[model samples]
Target: MTGTDEGRLHTAVLVGPEGEHRRHRKARQKAATRIESTARDARKAQAKARRDAEQAERRNTTYLPSAGESGPAALRTPGRLRLPKHQDTSATLAGQYPFLAEGGLGSSGVFVGQDLYSGGSFVYDPWVLYQQGLITAPNVVLAGIVGSGKSSLAKSLYTRSLPFGRRVYVPGDPKGEHTAVAEAVGGKAIVLGHGLSNRLNPLDEGHRPSTVSDVEWAMQVASRRRDLIGALAETVLDRALSPLEHTAIDLALRDAVRSAEVPILPMVVDRILAPNPADDEDGRLAEDGRLVGHALRRLVAGDLQGLFDGPSTVRFDPSLPMVSLDLSRVAENSTLLSVLMTCSSAWMESALSDPNGGQRWVIYDEAWRLMAYPALLRRMDAQWRMSRHFGIANMLIFHKLSDLDNVGDQGSAMRALASSLLANAETRIVYRQEADQLGSTAAALGLTGTEQKLLPGLGTGQGLWRIKDRSFVVQHQLHPAELAAFDTTTRMTEIARKISDLDVPSGISNDQEES
Candidate 1:
């Protein structure tokens, strides 16, 4: 072993050590990779096990009716299988008709309760029921005191209902609650007032100015009140006859107007009421003069101008998603008339003309006032008569059932009419009310004890909801903007801008135009 032999041996030892170190590194890397892959596989298996367990739990929890269960279950099965008494039949029943526990507002499709027992057990979910088309053609009646948040609840309902593409028409003078809702939903608001009318120039717009003929047609459709018509006719005869008459009188007045080629109303007055010297000897003229004179006098004085002027009277275009008739400036009765005339006419035309068959919802905030008019009564009757075919819904709001009674005998008729309307509504909402009136209105609608109990405790924006055949109460939460949108000023500038575009004539001035 010389010096060269010792160096070679040391080099061999170093090379051997290097080879062992390389083999160890490779084995460690392989082990680490195997561990990572095994960990991933374990995690996946754990997740799958958890999912399977959850599915099994759901299957076990879902309700299904037992052998002896009757009605819906019996109907579904032609033959029955006997089961032990301890088998928990109630769970099975609940599973079969989940809606029985949840109610109409629970699922998407319409749920027609099989029995009164099952129907009464239905719960309500406003959001779910509305989305499912289960509550189509809802006629919502909002009843509450002045500050009981009726308007707020109405706004919530309108906004929530708009996503379904239903045409929502709110009268112009909404207590300022629905304006924001209209805007938020991409709808239009037409503020009705003297300023709106004066600025819009409805007469020159060529939207077919409302004639006495239109008024007569509206009246004829509106009421069977012959006395009201007779009174109106006599009033027209005494002072000035606009060339319009009842359908019975249209031909005669039209012929006269055509022969003279003059606007009819003023001319009719001249012919009927201008004291005729030729008739003085007949004695018939003097005897019947008083009644005719009184009738004509009242007709001329009784705001007939609104009839002719109303069509051109500051109406919002139906093309807009929403139209608000800002009747804040108009007298209450006059406001009611204006809303009834405008909305009813627009609805009639839309129902007749629109081919796509869209549904339109007309919401009346202080609906009792419109119910007072025979014309409005007739319109509502027509709406009810035509609702299924025309896809129109009327959402009428009143403080109480008795508020409807304020309209006199007409009120009673309206109440009966309203009952029919509610029957057609499919969806009914009864919010918080005084303890006294609560029981009666609730009973009238056939609400159960549980429902009645729920009514008194309803919070703001909360109330009972009955969709189609089911009833339950819910607390509705509104978006902040929606709550604030009811501010009157939100759409004022836009409305003013629209009015400014109308070719309104400058010559006509109205005392009501002072704003």
Candidate 2:
């Protein structure tokens, strides 16, 4: 500043104290820049030393080329990866991939439950399956241990089908389980028993199909009546009828039909006991029918009287949504139960024979009791065989598959008839079964090892549905309303919560043994 300011002294005087402030600011920035240059020199020195060391290290190191190791130790192959294609049934392939499930019965028909394996909704309609050709038999065999929810499933199936314009018929409800369901669905329950005014004439001309001509109908009715009377007698006798007994029944039935416009069981019984002189020209006719006559007489004049001795007080309406024969009143009487079932079987036979009966559900609930009689069991086998021709679906419910063993002795005709009921049904729904029953049930239905193991672990409303050859583990869903309406344990449940010990019998189990 002394050499330069020599000529700038005059301007510095004009600049005053402000010029001195500017000079001091410039001096401070110059000092800071000097300090920064000193720090930058130190950094450059450190960088140069680092670069030299790195170059020395690089000279000592070895590396591979960009194309990778150039030797046999490269561990690389020239060929691309490949995999073989697999071919097998879905079921066999599912073993290779355990997460897979049954390609469910498609999204059509009734939504009965959820498919446990597929993680999708499960739908089942016997007729739908038949239409899809997945099953040729529209009949179903439902088996489960007592309180295993078979009853509820049966009810769900028929009730759900009502919306699709199908009808239901419970030929006999020994425990009256279907009575409420029948009533709830706007149908009639023909409740008949002792002390009740209700009566069912076995000879009542039942529903005549529109497709039948008068002559054809007459012949049909006559044949049905004759067969029904003989079947009733056989039921009461606990064995098949002889040729002579059959002849006497036919002759006596002819006499009754001629004598009364609408004949009753008593008329046939009286004619069989004391044959009309004109009809029984042979003196041996009365003796031939004595055993058969007395057996039927029990239905009209003995312990089984009052329900079928006169013209029917109730009519079997084919157009109704459902019809259930309530034999609970006489369930205690084996003879009476068989007689009622035999009579109702004829009623249903007439309805089923009609071409216009539409699609119907012929359910045999508590089938074990019905099969005890040879006549009813024979009719069941016939219905199961002819289910396709009749446009009707039949469901045979059992407490367990082993119940069929009680039908008759091994290799007996009755045993074969009972076995035929299951043989014709392709849809077998199995709920929770007892440990002892798993073997027979699995063998009878051809369940897979996994399916057999699944039975014991099934919760309520869970069932293994084997429709034809395919299988699904279904969890049946119900609406709050459907659940409340379908509940069968109301009696036991009500007896628990409200009534005091002194007012009720204490045998209530917290868990419902039957749904």
Candidate 3:
């Protein structure tokens, strides 16, 4: 340490060559630069190889087609997923993905059944909903295929509502499906047909309201009688009445009213067919009324006589819990069906317009049949429009929404009326429909793609309910008693079951078996 330190100190003291020190520093810097350059080139080579391999793999890769793979492999092949598993409470998870299901319509109204989406009980009441400001209209339109249990749903809705002090009035039941139900619910079913002793006078002064004066009622009765006579004529004629025909009907109805406190259709037909000279004024009045008189004559003395010819055997009691006109016997005759439904609707209209009628359900079963006539369809449209004012809910049932197409010619008044019925109905309950029916059904209902898809897949008693802007998929539950009362498949499927239950053997009557 002594010798070396001494030599170094002597060299430093001597101020060794400054050019030598500079050379040493420059050499060290050059060596370090060479090492860094070699390392950079090596890295570039490795990166190039990696990029080439990636490009080659991309070119060789095959992707699934838009229509997916063919054969059994179709849509089954996919890239492996590597997402990390997640764990969280449902409430916290809702923060990320919310509104998975509806909160529900609250715990009011009638208990309908189960809500498919919310996994809870569903409830619906048009009146309740209207009162709550959720809907403005109380009318409902129900469409479903035959045997789809739509009838059951309708029965359930109305019957369950009876306890709430609501009344039901089925103006025309073509199949008589509601007869048993009406009787079971302590209501009345007026069965009228060709052979039945029951009779109906469309001119019967229906229940009078205390709000109207005697003079006002008189005017209303006159106006109603005149309209009824004209409507009956048009229904039988299958066309609107001419101005001359209207005059004929008015004169005939006035004459009938003068003759009796409550005149029958026969008297009106007679007066129109043979107008009194003093009233005719013009000789052509008889001729002008001939066609209309004959058209109405059918209801009194012709083929359509048995039901409306004589004084009404059964009265229209608006105070009853329910009143359904059973037209099953007359359903086979189109003209009879139209005429009877027209009369029945007029009968119901008076009670419906009564301010004291309270809340009621006016059901038009097999509406397609009733809608065939222009006058009847118009009347239905009027009733639907006035439902809110009268505090009544009108439910129009259809085998399918396409039945509306059969009402009238395209763009005709009847068609517009049919469309309006759908528009006024804020609640639309659709049960199972055929594949072909989905398009028009969806179009008429304003259903989403999801709701439309739900139509064909619905089970029995299941319906997609669109109440105003809200949607609910409900599974309607039925009591065994209701099931028995609402069973329409009796003719098609229950005969064998009934037979098997008999203690007697097949083909053996009870008397014969006992003998």
What would the per-residue lDDT of candidate 3 be over residues 307-332, giving only the tens digit for each residue? 88889999888888989989888788
Best by TM-score: 2
Tens digits of per-residue lDDT, candidate 1, 1-515, equal 89999999998987897889998999999999999999999999999999999999998895655555567755666655788776565635567754544433343322222223334423332334445666655456667665556676666555555555656666544454565566667776555443343323211212222333667544533332222333245323422233223432332233334445323233333434443444344544433444443453332334433333322334555555666554554555453344334443443443333445466667777777565554455556666667556556667788775565455455466566656666666666776777777767766678767677776676665566666666555555546775576433447878988888877568667754554
Q: Candidate 2 has what TM-score?
A: 0.79
Off by over 4 Å in 3: 1-99, 498-515
Model 3 pairs whose backbones collide: none
Sorting all predicted structures by TM-score, with the top scorer first, yields: 2, 3, 1
| Distance from true location, Cα of 107 in model 3, Å | 1.6
Per-model TM-score, in order, reads 0.54, 0.79, 0.79
In candidate 2, list every pair of residues with a backbone clash.
147-513, 147-514
Clashes per model (N, Cα, C within 3 A)? 23, 2, 0
Cα lDDT tens digits for candidate 2, 1-515:
68777769877786899888999999999999999999999999999999999999999998888667756876777554678987888766668865666788898888898888787998888888898899998999998887778888899989999999999999999999899888999999999989999989889899988889999999999999998998898888888999999999999989888878888888888888999888767688999999999999898888878888887889999999999999999888988888889889998898998888889999998888888888888888888889999999999989899999998999999899988888899999999999999999999899888889999999998999998888888989888878888898898988876654544336765464232
